[model samples]
Target: MFVTRSVSDLVADSEGEGEKLRRSIGPVALTALGVGAIIGTGIFVVIGEGAKLAGPSLFIAFIIAAVTCAFSALSYAELASSVPVSGSAYTFSYATLGELVAFIIGWDLILEYGVSVAAVAVGWGGNVNEFLKATFGFVLPDAISKSPSEGGVFNIPAVFIVLLISVLLTLGTRESARLNAIMVVIKILILLFFIVVAFTSFHSGNFEPFAPEGFGGIASAAGVIFFAYIGFDAVTTASEESKNPSRDLPIAIIGSLVISTVLYVLVAVAAVGVAPVDTLSGSDAPLAAALNEGAGIPWAGGLLAAGALIAITSVVLVIMYGQTRIFFAMCRDGLLPRRLAKVHPRYGTPARLTLGFGVLIAILAALVPLDEIVKLVNIGTLFAFVLVNVGVIVLRRTRPDMPRPFRVPGVPVIPIIGILLCGYLIAQLPWETWLRFVVWLVIGLIIYFGYSIRHSRVRLGEKADAPSVEKA
Candidate 1:
């Protein structure tokens, strides 16, 4: 029989664990972490891809995606505030939905966080190579620096960065959070600089025929631009580390979404203004290309590339961090191997899981051309968002007496909108992406039936009574 975990028991497990994650992040740092994760390749690269699909109306797409994310963010805020645990949507699903649903979301998060880190790592490798070639006239050989699909042996730079970030994460979460904050500032400043310089070359004529392909184009672009807002959920993953989770988690989650939306809209406007959509679509380094070739600012291109390197670095760090935490949560619940739940004795972070994810992601980054897989990442995230919004409604009806520090306003209405919007965005993805999502879900089901269902701690009577309370 399927049973839902209770919120109280979930909280109890976190506190009862022998080694606990240290609470070291405050609102300011947590907000910065959200910005760091959200502002990476989406702004630097996906903006151009989005522009390619929607032309100047990419601005409208940005608004659509942002609004959708805002609704979902409200759902996340309420759950994180009430639970304040480490599993993100996975834990929330476990509390409100059944173990099967929670396990599905947890498996889906692997695609969201793991593939995202690999995709961003590939972007980082390219930016670093660009910085080297432009600044010092040094380029690593194509054989070692390019993915196999791109006609190279392996992407050494991507592998190297993933491994390096893993070591940093292993060192300690607090130390990594500090470094992430600094990098976030540098990334934001560089983007602001791009907006300033690009504005100087803005032409009114560029606004002509804005919706070249009409609303269809806008919706398509919204689907692509959804990738930019992917990192806001990373904030909820840090609930265990937040000094004041009930208050800070909501602020960090919503605050980061608002800040990233404004920046993305501004950047999209500046990009379209300074360069023709066709030109932006053709280039890999869209932002840098706009500043250098389109706006006639040669030096700013190099700086933008350097900033992109830092931006992608911070993204890989946070996404990988989220991945480990999700795995840590699953391991703790006996949905996966318990050994992965071991925290570092000294650092107090999930060292084993962190290292495990890093190695797997490094291998993925080193060999795969992640362009196709990035869409898969988006689909997985949207799926989780859909489940989370539903979980909000389920929890509200089932646990009306539960203490919620930050309640999602409008309750059923807001969550319903969130669900419909997320479903729409998921439908916007390619049919191929849906196929891939189904295949991955099937694999997850096999693993769950084969391993997780039998070994679940609740099934073993460790926490059997906990689920019955909710069942009653």
Candidate 2:
């Protein structure tokens, strides 16, 4: 049960019929994918939430979150290079820790990626509503546009966007990557536009009390904005699709984190400088609202809103893509139904799993108010990061001779710091969030013990007859 699949065998298995993912993405596209996923909800929506908690010290919060992410990103870079598989942390844990631990991490990732896509979709719904109102003077009623928690019957726009992205993904990975890259560029340009325009109206008084609530506030803000940095690991999920996983995976993972960090810091600084903390906190479309009301640029608000729509769409696309890949890996390993592992004959994508995720995310986006649940995504992601750091340490001690294309600079120190920081962030989450995570894990354990343990191909030796499975 604890047997780990050799990297060489896994690579060989990937070449099997109907299971192979196309290797079309390069380092540039992978980096763009990371940036696309990382920049969405955090910069566009969560920044206001962070600013509310930390005041003008949101910039410091961004730094704190970035530093914490840097530790985990290095670990991810190392593992992605060494493992070069589809399952991100899940695959790493299976190879290092054990199948049970891998299942747990994979389940946690479902919470991270699945719930995040839903949450981002909700955010997207808000921006779509704003954009519609700004552009065409059309408004969606609260009953149809908001989740029940937010006094709406359903969030139709959110559901619509998820389904749209799912269809795009089902068509092909390369096509989706190109569209994602384009959207990323457009959003970045819009953000730069906001920064330039808002900088002209910067007010020193807005930062009077940089840490109004003190260090505690900064810590709280860091926890809030930590969600922004959640997507860099999503790049690792594309390991199978990367043209040169060993070299390109590390570059994509690290490069995306660096690029997004700088943009987040600059955007946070510009946002607070142009608007009062109170105003930003109260806004639904914070950046656009800041530009319209605070900076006195009403026209720019429309442009920013349009950019946010594109930004959130890219985020939903990449995140859902990550979720499907994780599920595909699990299915391939017999942790899930094998049908989920089926790749489309024509598109070479996991069309079935993509549709499945689309349906579930659409229901969540349509009916659930995901504000409180966003914190759950953060806690879940941090838990996965902790396990990943631990897995890196375990792999080093157990497989010292393994060839790693990109080794983390500081082995024990970096991973240790990563585990500690992730643990701290997890602690900062509300008790309610912790309760939900525990409940979710309990459910996963039940499913695992009941079915996965019995069905896992690794345990059953089902692959013993296959030549490729024995090659390594």
Candidate 3:
């Protein structure tokens, strides 16, 4: 019988990146990285839309979504401790599920990280324009401000930011992490500001008919709005670089989830309390607009705009970082060109992949009407979550003797629930999104069978069963 490489083998691949680089990340900074990735434009932009669809029960949607995420987070914590590599679910799946599943996940993550960077870039432009107009009374012409898919000439700023972040990422991971930490601080403070001001003027009446759209709507809203939770997985991508992979990796992954869920719920409650669900859902700048209307303060919009700009920029950086790392992992596995996996001599980062991903994301951000393709991000992520949770169960049975520094409580139950919840969430997504995901997976199948399967490092006997070793 043919056997797939175990998670331990995959983690051992980090030896290529070396031990010095691997120990640069500490637990607090790792948690901050997780939070930086997790909290962003989603809270500022998507929550209102969820509220509109789910009514005041959008709060319930947040809870439901968080619970679903927690199941996966628990699974992820266990795996991150076990594998401790940079590819996130893709690397984990490859070790436990086989090359076919790994290829699909690697392809799926292209949607989660690459596509999301573009969406966030487009969103970043909107916030920047708003900040400019509010602070200095100037706005970009529609020709320059809107994405090509949105009936505009080009979103130059969006493309520019993607390129800039790409360059920054290629320069060094440490530098990028430091910048992201600062931006995360500013963005979190802004959110705290909203909570303080909005709650002072909260209205109980706004919650009337809490589930106006009913259970179906709430579930569907959870599907559509799930992208808000996409970035936390980036935390797991840093496992290889973590100072204490076993102890800190789990804290960073699960701790970020706890922090982000609380922040998301608070932000949603604050936004819904100040405005009607319908109005909040329709506004382009929901948080800023809601703050402006509720507080009757003229500068509220400007402040929120400033915050959103910082929030989305941090998101762009983190996602871009994740994209480069995932691509690097695939290339190192011989699933792609080895040149793409080379670390920058000066920066100790994946320069080629970083620059390549940046350019690709910029073009997509500049040309593609990503609003339509956005839901695929959530679908891809949910699929990854399912695999991760299931991987937890598989590893438990296959390697019962393998050390697990952070074991998820109620193993089989948590993993099973995680799989079911992810499936339910995916089912709630529009049929078109599923079709698009299938199409992407088919393309991945062709690529894998045509080249990757034969070229894989495991197939070449370089390290076969013990290619890479993960720390627990």
Q: How many clashing residue pairs, candidate 3?
A: 5
The model with the greater lDDT, 1 or 2, is: 2
Better of 1 and 3 by TM-score: 1
| Residue 102 miss distance in model 1 (angstroms) | 0.3
Clashes (backbone N, CA, C under 3 Å), per candidate, total 0, 0, 5
Candidate 3, residue 306: lDDT: 91
- As for model 3, its CA RMSD to the true structure in angstroms is 3.6
Please list the Cα RMSD from the true structure of every candidate, rounded to 1 decimal place: 4.1, 3.0, 3.6
* Ranking of candidates on lDDT, top first: 2, 1, 3
lDDT of 2 by residue, 331-427 (tens): 9888988767777767878888899889998998898767777645467678889988998898899889999998987889999999999887776
Lowest summed lDDT across 10 adjacent residues in model 2 is found at 463-472
Clashing pairs in 3: 9-468, 11-469, 12-468, 12-469, 13-468
Return the TM-score for each candidate structure: 0.94, 0.94, 0.93
Model 3 TM-score is: 0.93
Query: What lDDT is obtained when candidate 3 is compared to the true structure?
Result: 0.80
Q: Model 1 residue 66 lDDT?
A: 93
**Candidate 3: Cα lDDT at 308:** 86
Runs of candidate 3 exceeding 4 Å displacement:
1-3, 16-22, 213-220, 375-377, 464-472
